[model samples]
Target: MDTIGHHYIVEAAGCDPNVIGDANKIREIFLEAAKRGNMEVKASYFFKFSPMGVSGVVIVAESHISVHTWPEKGYAALDVYTCGENADPEKAVDYILEQFKAQYAHVSEIKRGIEEEDRTFTHTILTWEERLDRRNGKP
Candidate 1:
């Protein structure tokens, strides 16, 4: 199987103190950022009062973006996961950071793919080998 995708985790600290605690405000921030990043959002939800703070998720056609806000600590956690060659999650991350006016941010990106695995006959060969071994009474 061909697996190609990109996933990003972005965390921000010392966000604009004003924007950190409210779920509604956080939702608005994400909506605006999505527009700025040119991402197509299908649906979104936000919730407040988690131990970690407020949390929200935006389900996008490209993938999804999620945020957790901690106004008490002036921190927010973000994650963006996307598949397909054209999904630019980095733009989304940058837009979010800019919107929140994050003072210190940490971003981690991971590229996913399958490299050099013989897919054609490996399964068939393995099955045949297993059958032969069974016939030979080798558990």
Candidate 2:
């Protein structure tokens, strides 16, 4: 189907708190993820919270990748959106999860700006979960 963009909404759990709490590391991770996903990075910024947490965004030519973290809960929320044909949001998401060492993740993908025959626009959503630490064939 033809659409304007792909947006990935992700919830990652069982991650390393330290990794997610570090703003500098997250900025680095996001930049690398943009490269890994074949995205053209225009600019980026990240902020670290007192106590424990972080928030950040990487703006790309196609769209952007953003994240928020709760270190105390070992959880993170991420959004990867892109409209360019050359951009791979999935690859970027995967890299982010791997870098955070997430043991489990729930991902929802939305096909945005779906134009109908009547010139209307709509979106489609698909959701799934991954058990990244499936040791001994068990999640």
Candidate 3:
């Protein structure tokens, strides 16, 4: 099977710190992104820090979408990963970025698991006698 993952970094210059500190707002943004990306969310959880910040994850049938916020720094990070072809992680990332409304952001994406160039191939030439020897090794 083919697998793909999108990891992103959000750098904010002029964002409301209070918004990032709210767990409910962060969760809402993530759930909306998941819907726009066509991900089937199986479970979800969020945690509010002692004094600031919010962290949460939405477990989806395709894989998962997660987010973490830093109100003090006006920054947030996200990871959207999936194992199948039906989900569009990039769309999710874009939507989340827009929600953040950061003055500036540096975003990136990568393909995870089963990359073609990273694969290895083996070729063997064998006769009937060699094939018999191979079977012996299997046992």
Candidate 4:
């Protein structure tokens, strides 16, 4: 089956609190990630919560990359979706994990718009966990 796009869902734990709490920083990181993924930037928006955390999105020609952070919990959730062969969604995901300094991450990749023989559209998913850094007593 052929997929029209790739969607990466990420659960990043033990991230840097300062990085995730700053809306400006997160916006910068997301834009850079999109560029590295071979995506063309369309528009972007970010918001800072009352006391903590940040939420942002970078809309790209291929698709979009978005994130929400929980500074108190040292956690972040991200979605990287891209269409067409030219873009690599994984690159964006990797950049995010690196910039956040995540100690552990659980990632899921969904192949979107998969066409079946009967002309019905469906999706396939693959998931894995990555121990990005070992210093923080992560399991």
Candidate 5:
């Protein structure tokens, strides 16, 4: 298999507006989620917008989890990307929704790092003729 990563796009709605705007709460929720998902949380940072929103990212050994919340709309958008097969991104999403008490959430999953089989680029693989051409200084 060419894929090496798993990515999840989450659309959360009907969340607790006040909790979504709290940077500290958001960070706490993400940290717990990372732990639950088996991701190593190395560092985290968050910024609270003046009008009422929070944006934060949790950097993990596998990859990262980010959240952008719009409290006024009772919504949050999240992206969870992790390398290797052991990490469970869905667990993280579920925890986030639970933390915010989200009434509804739509999640879309995609496998990353997939290479097409139709063609092979020289950078990836080269035939004997191509190697010889390189040695001969021919394009």
Candidate 6:
């Protein structure tokens, strides 16, 4: 079996308008979501825009979580990417939606991996050539 990477995209609509413009609140939401997903957040940064918006990224060991909020539109877009066992990006998405009191959310999940048969002789030949060149000190 091939190793796989999981990625998630989450969009929330009809979120509380007040929450969108606050950088501190947005940070709280992200931290809470990371905790709920059992993800370790190493660092984060957020910026607040006047007239109502916030944007931020949380650096997590598994990968990262990012969000942008629009208060006027009552909408938020989020991306959660993780590449290892015990990382559930879906849970993080759910936590954010619930925290923002979103009326509805759109979620997408994609699994990334090379198909077994798709890794044919051509791929192997290229890999072998690269290895041989590296071993022979041929740039």
- Candidate 6 lDDT, 2-51, residue by residue in tens: 34656676666777777766889889989998888878889999998876
Residue 17 CA displacement from its true place in model 2, Å = 0.7
Superposed by TM-score, candidate 2 places the C-alpha of residue 44 at a distance from the truth, in angstroms, of 0.5
Backbone collision count in every prediction?
0, 0, 0, 0, 0, 0
- Give the alpha carbon lDDT tens digit for every residue of 61-100 in model 3: 8588877788888767767776577777778866766666
Error of 4 at 32 (Å): 0.7
Off by over 4 Å in 4: 1-3, 134-139
Please give each candidate's TM-score: 0.72, 0.92, 0.73, 0.92, 0.79, 0.76
TM-score preference between candidates 2 and 5, better one = 2
Q: Residue by residue across 11-63, what tens digits does model 1's lDDT show?
A: 67767656767777778877876776567889999888855478799987757
For candidate 2, lDDT tens digit of each residue in 1-139?
A: 2459999999998888878999999999999999999999999989888887999999998589999999899899999999968889999998998888888999999999988999999999999999887521221
Candidate 1 local lDDT, residue 22: 72
Error of 4 at 105 (Å): 0.4
- Candidates in order have lDDT scores of 0.68, 0.89, 0.66, 0.89, 0.77, 0.72
Where does model 5 exceed 4 Å of error?
A: 1-3, 118-139
Tens digit of per-residue lDDT, candidate 5, span 18-63: 7898999999899999989999888999999987899999998858
- As a whole number from 0 to 100, the lDDT of residue 113 in candidate 2 is 92
Writing each residue's lDDT as its tens digit, candidate 4 over 1-139 gives 2359999999999999989999998998998898899999999999999899898999998588999999999999999999998998888898888888899989999999988899999989999999989643432
lDDT of residue 90 for candidate 4: 89
Better of 2 and 6 by TM-score: 2
